[model samples]
Target chain A: MLSCTGYAARSASDPLAPFSFERRDTGPDDVRIEILYCGVCHSDIHQARNEWGNTLYPCVPGHEIVGRVSEVGTNVSRFRQGDVVGVGCMVDSCRECKSCRDGYEQYCEQGFVGTYNGEDRQGRGITLGGYSKSVVVDQAFVLKVPDGLDLAAVAPLLCAGITTYSPLRHWKVGPGQRVGIVGLGGLGHMGVKFARAFGAEVVLFTTSRGKIEDGLRLGAHEVVLSTDKEAMARETGRFDFILDAVSAQHDINSYLALLKRDGTLVQVGAPEDPLPVSVFSLLMKRRNFAGSLIGGIPETQEMLDFCGAHGITADVEMIAMDEIETAYARMLRSDVKYRFVIDMNTLAASA
Target chain B: MLSCTGYAARSASDPLAPFSFERRDTGPDDVRIEILYCGVCHSDIHQARNEWGNTLYPCVPGHEIVGRVSEVGTNVSRFRQGDVVGVGCMVDSCRECKSCRDGYEQYCEQGFVGTYNGEDRQGRGITLGGYSKSVVVDQAFVLKVPDGLDLAAVAPLLCAGITTYSPLRHWKVGPGQRVGIVGLGGLGHMGVKFARAFGAEVVLFTTSRGKIEDGLRLGAHEVVLSTDKEAMARETGRFDFILDAVSAQHDINSYLALLKRDGTLVQVGAPEDPLPVSVFSLLMKRRNFAGSLIGGIPETQEMLDFCGAHGITADVEMIAMDEIETAYARMLRSDVKYRFVIDMNTLAASA
Candidate 1:
């Protein structure tokens, strides 16, 4: 076992603090990563506070990881020492399952092992995430980070980036299509960028009027204040596809109504409470309402490559390790510009 | 104008009674049909009682019409006098829209005219449906019923059959796939038969155990009482596609859970209230929830042809025109075998 240090929540109500733990030694198929940056996801807060009622403590909640490979086992030929890589929401999965075999390990039938608070498939203990200084994961799950991109901005691509990219690509969003991105947060911001990068006419639907300029700067062609009834009404039956990234409760029917006949709305955000979906909205135009998880390992690499080609990276606010609680509070109030990525170098300074 | 005798609802509370009305002379693109049979749909009850709050007074509610063409206008090349024909939910749609041009007129951008309680596009008054002695419709809205199928049994095919069949075909429910049909009513019964004819391994889900035997008889490989927790639990992630024909409120998440990864559940029933959908259920496996209205004119003809080849027809309980009130009452109690078809020949006897 390798000794490691991370920031973790001792209990649901407690603040995350510096803690020491042990990680499994680099196995033959494993790559040990020195985590450089970790993007804060909203779900990290949910699991840390047990809002989803499934948190295991001391919980280290960070999945959007970008790092340099510090060590690799004998069989880990794909990843060499010092290679920059990424680890998203998953660390391991039952590789024998259909989803795993099909390159969609995120939807593995045996349940993909989450990066934090997830039971390690190898029986090492609960998997600790990138809040730590280092992590050891199987080579199969590590994604190659493209060159010439800001690694801090690339962190969120593991979660927010892949969450939006997979759906847009799966639904075939491209030129001559009007795409709508609901909310302008961690996921939505990336959604706007990707939708625009995919050669689509991107519309950003945000309740915040302040996000108008930012949404446009992020590549949205139009930004509609969703609170404006008349503006929303005008967009009715106009969208070819909509990517909803709002985790907060909102009327999904309004967005569902914006789709053209046979259009689709894919939700990447998982609202705690079930949203009341108007069947009439779907039935009226044969519209579809679907949801997507982060992404598969192969797709995640594809997203990173696509981002590299398009010069696409999440607009991020970097934070120190010790300021996580403050970041969490600000995140709850929707105060971040987009995402908050923790610089792991600050971990030792906090200690 | 042609004088006609029919049963009409003068007010929301009034039971349908004998009334005199008029039909326009067959126009250049029209086909005049002497009604032989009209199938009762649950929507008819909603319209007659103004439950949808949009019903026009003296509503003649019936769209599932199977009859003989009594007259055809000068330009009506598809049908000749005395030809068997059918008409479903829609009477006319703006043929210029993309949806209409794509042969999906039911999703017409201009709003396809409902056979009953819909404002006509040609300056005619609110259209009265096929609860009458005759109806004159545009040739584009009329369908040719096959020669061999029982005409009375074919009445419900106009609405219930097409409603179920369209979604099944759209979702590609076929051999090697496991399909689920929710409910055991008019639409559900037709859904089971069509799913079976599509060569799928069919499972019927119903709240009532009494329908188990009937569900199997109607081509279901298995009948699982949806209310039986253990039975329903065993079906988790089992279906490739599920056609929900239930209009009543139920736990939609339970059904959503039954879908395999990337599976779809299409709703054809219009439940009065919005269904609460767990975003987690859809997000976890990337499942889809969609809705489909009744099929287009061309697809309706295709469905008729498909049924003609498969020797399929709705199992119907025949009733006289005067027994509509009793039929509606029994329908409310879910007492009909599957559908209730009004024998238009009995209209004169009731008068």
Candidate 2:
């Protein structure tokens, strides 16, 4: 067993605290990496608090992982010691499923194992995530972090980045298309960058006037305050595709009306409640309301490479390992500029 | 001006009554038809009773029309006098829009004019539908009812048949695919026929155990009572395409669960209230919840041709023109085997 240190919630009601655990020794196909940074996601807060009602504690919550390889098993040929790598929302999936064969391991029929609070397939206890100082992962689930990108800023790309990127790519958003990014949070910010990088005419839909300048700085061509009926009405039937990143309870019909005929609004964020959708809203325009999870491994790697090529990375605030609880509080208030990335070296220093 | 005798609702609270109205004289681009049969659609009842809150009375409620061409203007080259023709839901659309140019007139950006209770583009008056003795329509909106098919049964094909066929065709449902038809009403019956015709393995989903034998008769390879939890459980992640023809309020999430990864559940029926959808239902499998209106003019024509080639028409119960009110009552109870075709000769005899 390899000793590891991480921040973990001892119970649903407890705040995250320093915890020590053991990771499996590197298997024949495994690559062991010393953690560098892990991005704070809204879901991490949800799981840490057991808001989704299925938390396993002491829960070490993180999935957006970025690290430097320190050791590699004998059969790991694709990576070497000292290589930068990442692991997103999933740690492992049933490899024999058709989805796994097709490289969409995130949607494995038997359910992919989550990075944290998930049953471990390797006979270990519940899997811990990237909040730790070190992790042992199969090479197949580890992604190559592209060169020349800010490592901390690249952390969110593993979760928020891939969650938004998969839908844009799956829908084939590209040049000459009108794309809309709903919300301006961590996910929406990346969506704007990726859509802009794809050469699309990007429109940012937000309720906050403060995000207008940041939206443009992040690559949106236009920002429409979604609360303004006149402005929203002007954008009616304008978007070819919309990426809905708002997890808060919102009337999705208002957004559905913005889509052009045959257009789609893909929800990447899962809210606690179901959305009430007027069938007529969809029927009249032949529009689609779809939802997409974080991407498959192949596409996640593709997104990272695309980000590297386009000079795109999430705008992030650096926080020390001990500040995650405070960061999560600020995140709930939409106080972060975009994302919070934990500096795992703080865990090392504290250890 | 030409006088026409038809059955119409004088007010939302009133039942069908004999009414006299004027239709325009046949113009150069017009074809005048002596109505033979008209199918009773659920929307017809809604419109007649102001259920959708946009009725222009006296509402002559019918769009699924089959008739004989009694006269053709000089510019009407597609049809000669005595030719059989059909007219569906739409009357006219902006010919210059991209949707119209692309042959999807149903989704015209400027909105297509409805056959009844719609603003007339020619400034004649509110357009009236086909529960009448005669109709004069532009040659562009008139479809050719094929030979060697039951004319009465073919009436519903104009609306219900085209509505179902459009989605099946749009989603590219074809041979070796598994298709599910939700509900066992007018539209679902047509979906079963079209899916079976396309050589898909057809499954009919119904709440009524009584419809099991009828579902098999309507070309479904198997019928599953959607209310049976075990039966529905057996069908989880089973369908490639699900044509949702249920207009009543039902939990759509259960059916959404039945779709394979990347599969679509296309809603063709518009219920009174919005349907509640869990984003996780779509995100888990990358499934789609989509809506489709009646097909475009070109596709409707293609459907008619396909129906002709495949010997397809709606399963209809014949009724006198005066029996429309009674039929609408029965339809509300899901009592009709599929559709009711009003025999227009009853109108002529009463006159």
Candidate 1 lDDT tens digits, A140-215: 9899999999999999999999999999999999999999999999999999999999999999999988999999
Backbone clash pairs for candidate 1 read: none
Q: Per-chain TM-score of chain B, candidate 1?
A: 0.94
- Model 2, B118-182: lDDT tens digits are 66665556678888888888899999988899999999999999999999999999998899999
- The model with the greatest DockQ is 1
Superposed model 2: Cα runs more than 4 Å off: A1-21, B1-21
Among the numbered candidates, top lDDT falls to 1
User: Least accurate stretch of 10 residues (summed lDDT) in model 1 chain B?
Assistant: B1-10
lDDT of all predictions: 0.90, 0.88
- The DockQ score of candidate 2 comes to 0.83
lDDT of 1 by residue, B23-68 (tens): 4788899899999999999999999999988877767889999999
TM-score of each: 0.95, 0.95
- Report the lDDT of model 2 for residue A258: 95
Cα error of candidate 2 at position A50, Å: 1.9
Badly placed stretches (over 4 Å) of model 1 are: A1-21, B1-22, B349-351
